[model samples]
Structure formats: C-alpha cells, structure tokens
Target: MSFTNNIFLLMEKSLKKYGNNVHYSVLKEEVLNWINLKDGGIYIDCTCGPGGHSKYLLSSGKEIFIIGLDKDEKMLEIAKENLKGLKNFKLIKGGFENIKEILEKEKIDKVDGFLFDLGFSTPQIKDGQRGFSFREDGPLDMRYDITSNLTAYHILNKWSRRDLVFIFKNYGEIKNCERIVDKIIERRKKKKFETTEELANFICENFKERKKIHPATRFFLALRIATNDELNCLKKGLENSIPFLKKGGRILVISFNSLEDRIVKNFFRKTECIRILTKKPILPTKEEIEVNPLSRSAKLRVGEKNGK
Candidate 1:
C-alpha cells in the first residue's frame, strides 16, 4: 500500500483504540454552506477541538488546506490522531487569538476562512479528569491550556470575596451573589475547594437549580471562562484573524452561551472591515437540538471581510 493509505489504515486502527466517542460539530451544515469554501482554498479552524469541523473541511476538497489550532494539547492530540491520514492540514498548539503569529510562522499570508467553535468538546466535558463539567467529580482545574497558572481551584479557594463576587456577577451573571459569595468564602476558610463536586455541591446548597440547568452550571462556566480568560481571548482572536483574511473571506463563530454570542454580535456590528452576513444569528434546528441537547443554545454568526 502507498504511504498515505498506510497512514490512513494506521489512523483507523488508532481511532478504534479511542472508541467511538467523538465531539459533534454544532451547525456543521450551516457553517460549511455559509463559509462558501472553494476548491484549493485555505481555511483555519481556530478552535479545532477534536477536528470535527476540520475533518469535514478536509474531506470537502482534496486541495482544501486547513490549519487547525487549539490551546488544549489533549484536544489537539485527538485532532491530530483523527486526521493523521489527511493531507493538506497542519495542527498547531496555541490560542486561537495567536493566529497572526501562527500564520506568520507558517509563512502563510492569508486564508479563505476562519472558524471558531466556542464550545467544549465531548471529550473535554465527559472526561471527569479535565474538570470542565460538574456532572462528574474531578479536580477544579478548568484551564483549557493546562500549562496556564490559573485554575478553578485557585479562583474559588484563594481569591477574595470581592473577586469571587465579581466573577459570579459579571461572568456568571448570577444576581444577588452576596450570600453565595459569602458562603463560598466561609467554606473555603474551613477547607480548600479542590474538586468539582465540592464546588458543585457548595453552589447547589446555596442556590436552587435553575429551570433546566444545574445550580452549579453558571458557576462552573464562570470559573472556566475566568481560568482561561476566554472572553478576552475570543475578542482578540476575532480581531487578530480579520487582517489576515482574504477579501470576501469569512469568519464564522459558533458560540454556545449568551455572553459569547453577545461578544460575537458586537464584534460583527462595530468592525468596519467586515460585513455581517447573518443579520440574525443562525440557530440550531429542532432536530439537531433533539439529537444533541447541548447544541440547543448554539448561535452561529458570520462575517465576510470587506475591502476597506
């Protein structure tokens, strides 16, 4: 067998070892259709995750080259192993916000599209060890980039009441957080918050569960966002990619929460160098939500680079 085919066979064998669990790319069809990918076009999967979108993009055309990036090495490993057989793709370990530096290093001047899927992959959330979810008990390390110094444990245990209140209020949008923050501070004084279950239980004890979400949902989300500085990174990522996009090239973002959606909406509105393609954000279909309930809140926004 040829070298490429042998690689493909090896990849298939490795995939069997990882099992069938895979991250499903939200709004896959809509994103592909709107990006308007061309033959031999170059694209960037800013948050490649487990390479769901990147794999599809690669399969779309033989000459469609993809530069897949993710801060999480574990996720990148999955992406790499999944696409090992694929040609015309490069996987990089870095923040999506560093796309300018990445492209510069790669000696590429511009790309046809940039795609950001701002949601946790199935592996990240399901793996209790990584601590992205409250469903399973694990450490409070919520850093997407594990090398980062900050973690959910540090914020909950070491941060002051004032800082705790700030994140709960601002990032989690938890109103009337004085009582919750007070409780957190008091508990941490007795014992350091170390595990996801500990925090989840603490938050649950303080606040009743919301309609469909857990009481700890917003708190965990806030901690993850804070630990990773996700909002800031997202803003920078969008800004950094714009200048590198070919004219008429698109930037697509699939954000899962209101905070991320708001940032994307505002960025698309105020940016002068891009035209908003989706006046209203495209939402997941009822069928998609039924299949993957996690996608219910996904909002996809598109912007095309305009000649200034």
Candidate 2:
C-alpha cells in the first residue's frame, strides 16, 4: 500500500478502536426528516465536518448522492477516510462560500437539498495544534483553510485597536471591552500575542465575569470569526446556494451562535423564493443536550425553495 493508504488505514483502525467516542452529527433525525431525501436525489453538505451529516444522508437508503465541501483539509481527509467505499459521493476541499463555482465546475446543475451545519467539530477543538481551543494552549493560528493568510495571531497582534473593539463588540457581543482592548494594546507592544493561552489569559485577567462560560469564550469566538470571515462566508454561501437548489428542494442550516442563527432566520424570511418551513427555529432536545452539552446552543432552521 502507498503511504497515503497506510495513513488512512491507521486512521480507520483507530476509529474502529474508538468508534464509541466519535462525535456524531447534531440533530440527525430532524435534519433527515425535514430535508426529506428523494430517491436518486443529489445533496450538498455545505460543512461536512468529518462526514457525519454526509454519512447520515448516504445511509438513508434513498440511493442519493452527496457532494461534501469543507475548507479544512484535515477534516476533509478524515471525511474521505470515514466515507471510504461509499458510492456516489465526492468530498471537496473548499469553503461553502464558493458553492456556486464548485457546483458549476462539477456540472451539477441542481441538487435536491443543501445542509449547512455551522459548528466546529470535536476534533477541531480537541486538537490544540489547530489553535481553536481556549482550554488548550497552542499557537494563535485559527484559519479554517490553513493556506489562508489571516490567523488569530495576526488579528490579535497586528489589527488596530478600533478593529479589535469592533469585532469584540459586534461579533462577540461583549459591549464593555475597553479595558480588555486597552490591555491587549499595551501587552502586544512589548511582546506580541503568539498563542491561544496567552490571549485567553490576557482577556481573562482584564475582563472578569460571573457566568458559566469562561471570560475568554466570547473573545476567542470573535477572534475566530474575524480570522475566518465566518459571518460573511455564511451569507455568501446561503445567497449563492439558492439559485442551484431544485424547486421544492430545501435548505437546512444548523447554527451554533446567535449571529449565525439570526442570519439564517432573516435569510429564510426575506427570500421570496424560499418558503420558511419552521416559523421558529428548532432546538436540540433535552436528551440531546444531556448526551452532548456542546449541542445545547445549536438551532436548526429549514426552508424550502418555492416555485416562484
């Protein structure tokens, strides 16, 4: 076997050994039921992290095909391994923002459904080397596409104080972050913020909170959003995807943050071509939250393309 095959074999073996602990997709039943996959239908998994949602769709016994897109190469590699031998599915390393170009390139005129699960996978947060976890100390890099030039490090050390304040206030919703910004400004002058821990600790030291979540949580979130241009990307993905969805096809978005949820909600409402299926967003059941607390924040909104 080749080196690549050997690596995939090792990963497969490891997954089999620890299959019980794997992080599955959120709201599997709800998503599958709402999308209502048709026989021989084609679907696009906009954020097919580790192939969980794609696997679920492929297993629906509808003889459906899937096109999975993700910006993270590591996630795509794992997705390829997890989906090994699955027929009629293709995994591409690209952001959902480029869905139009991707579909055009694939010559897939229209698809039955589009799924956007906007949450970081467990592997992403657990792997500190990727710099997503505030709990684990590592480099400040937080690009979903590693080849991307921007990183959390660049934002923290190089961005102007005004830009930092804007992100924290708007993206993070942390209204009173002047002290924190002032401290980051002061600290970066002497020694640039180079690691997740350094930035997390600095935020915590400057900003105190009595909430269940860490003080650095929103700060880190804002940094990740700014670094990845996540909000803008979501808008582009949603806007670009509608034209390619077959009439009567549906779009399901699982957003983990209020901002993303709001965007999906408003998009579903204002788009004359899409009929909002759920007037209110669906939340994870208590059982799901009990099983995986990380799922508590997830909100699923679905819309069907109208024939208009």
> Best-fitting candidate, measured by TM-score?
2
- Give the per-residue lDDT digits (tens) of candidate 2, residues 1-308: 54333433454454466662266588998999999999989999999888988988888888999999999988988888888878889989999999999999999988999999995886787678889878768999888899999999999999999999999999999998877899889999999998888888887778986555677888989989999999999999999999999999999999999999999999888899999999888899998865555677899999999893
RMSD of each: 7.9, 7.1
Model 1: lDDT equals: 0.86
TM-score of each: 0.92, 0.92
lDDT of each: 0.86, 0.87
Error (Å) of candidate 2 at residue 161 is 0.7
| Displacement of the residue 82 alpha carbon in candidate 2, Å | 1.2
In the range 118-199, model 1's lDDT, one tens digit per residue, is 9678788778888887876899998889898998888888988889888888898888888988888787888998899988
Stretches of candidate 2 above 4 Å error? 1-21
